[model samples]
Target: MAAGTRSRTGASAAEVATRIREAIFAGELVPNQRLVEADLAEAYGASRGHVRTALGELTVEGLVERIQNRGARVRSVPLEEALEIVEVRAAVEALCAARAAERVTDEQAERLRGIGRRMEDAVREGDQAAYAQGNKDLHGAVIGLADQRTAAATIDRLRAQAVRFQYRLSARPGRSQTSLPEHLAIIEAVCARDPEAAARAMREHLASVARAIAESARD
Candidate 1:
């Protein structure tokens, strides 16, 4: 995000933090990447104080690191740390899946179905942008069904870590073709109101992702 995003009236510390975090997650900022305060202040069109506050928040959240006598830069997540994140995500997502199965409404189900359709189209057309958008939609929809803001927030953070690994391995093979089908299976189970099945499917889906991430990390 241009640090100086013109003059947005709704501009606040939290908003600035979120924007910078997303930029870091989207690979606009690489691991161990230094952030120039003046440049960011100018780009964000905010004072150095505002940018500093945003950086402090992001640092606390583990998205960026600050060193004494140095400066702030994006943190580098080790492979072990990445695997731990995947494991935690598996359990939390499984709970959310089961919860969604118990409480999901028809409207929510349809919303998820729409996301699935888009992802399928992306897979068919081999469109990276579409796949990226669809993937976020599918995950966010599931998290929304659970209505657990804390879980959703944590997943966003973990996904940031995963995105770094993806950036490190640029041009690597696409995520497993089977991953989409696995997501669909979980969605179907939730829509069917099959909590047990949904939990199992979600677990399997995350397990597969963990495996894929580990393989890529080793390479």
Candidate 2:
């Protein structure tokens, strides 16, 4: 009975941790924002112990940090570190893009093209939200198509850490106009089953992103 209860609690903790992670990714929980155990417990409908455990897990994931005496808060990934993260993503996602091109089915190719169309429409209609969603869909589709669990997991964590910078870049004026072609190029390469081109496109896109991050830092 005790073992069963413990298992249930652990499951709940994992669930709560996922919720918190999603909240952070969705920008509901901003960097440096205090994570009060009581508040989290009440909001997530979990016990304080569960919240504590969830926070601990997130801390290990680099999403949370505990101060000497102020409990825990969302960790603020610095611009320099964010730039480094993007550099790493460039390499990893480039490999994924190439693998995706090699493995993409006809149906998956069409789906990627559809995402490109949506992105195009979003840019033309000046719909930042839709454009952002398409961007996510496109990358997610490529990652899924790659069929590399380890690479996918690494990208997920890296994305979580750099989501704030991504948001900033997305909101930049003329950013969509610039990135739209880059995204389309990636879709085209993958849909055409051109692994080298797909890899090149992915690296070029991330290089542009790295440049933008550096530019932002300069400004």
Candidate 3:
């Protein structure tokens, strides 16, 4: 087998799945774009079998869809469904924030504060890209602090499905400015070790996001 067509032994199915998942999240693999097994196998340095396995796994995660006769493609979540997904994320991530507040170590608290600072800098400099990245980093940090594998896994899958909508929301005029304080509230609550406050802040932030999504759908 050529280097590009490595044997299944080269990369595991789970590894291939992660590569494809990250590609989707990064917008490298766009919504409704066909995922040809042969192309994926070569691009990801995996066997066709592994690519197939990966596609099946991603389908289960709601990131990929198989057409009746056509091959798998990136799933395009509709705006309405996207709003529902955010609603669900709000609940689950609120739980994570509450747990993180209860369980955060001093070092973790410092990290959360650092992320908040970066977000503030990004907004001050009118750096939307940096602010968007900080948004992801802050949420990821809080989830890590929570140490709840189940909730983290759930959030990851939900995020994968709604990443396109997230990109849209981030690019909207004044979006980063509006969301900055909401994210800071989450960070401050978590850093303060106040579980109720953390959960409330998280819920409010996502509620704001959900409302934004709904508003955009009408425009």
RMSD of each: 3.8, 2.3, 3.0
List lDDT for all candidates, in order.
0.80, 0.90, 0.90
Give Cα distance to truth, residue 155, candidate 3, Å: 0.3
Q: How high a TM-score does candidate 2 get?
A: 0.94
Tens digits of per-residue lDDT, candidate 1, 1-219, equal 354453454355666788789898778888888988888877766677677878998888888899788888888888888888889998888888898999998988888888888888888898867876776777777788888888888888887876776554333566735678998898899989898999899999888877877888788
Per-candidate TM-scores read 0.88, 0.94, 0.93
Q: Judged by lDDT against the true structure, how good is candidate 2?
A: 0.90
* Deviating ranges (above 4 Å) for candidate 2: 1-11
Per-prediction tally of clashes: 6, 0, 0
lDDT of 2 at 9: 31
Whole-model lDDT for model 3 versus the true structure? 0.90
lDDT of 3 by residue, 1-219 (tens): 322343635676777898999999898999999999999888877788888988998998999999989999999999889999999999999999999999998998898889999999999999998998899999999999899999999999998899888888888889988999999999999989999999999999999999988777687
Sorting all predicted structures by lDDT, with the top scorer first, yields: 3, 2, 1
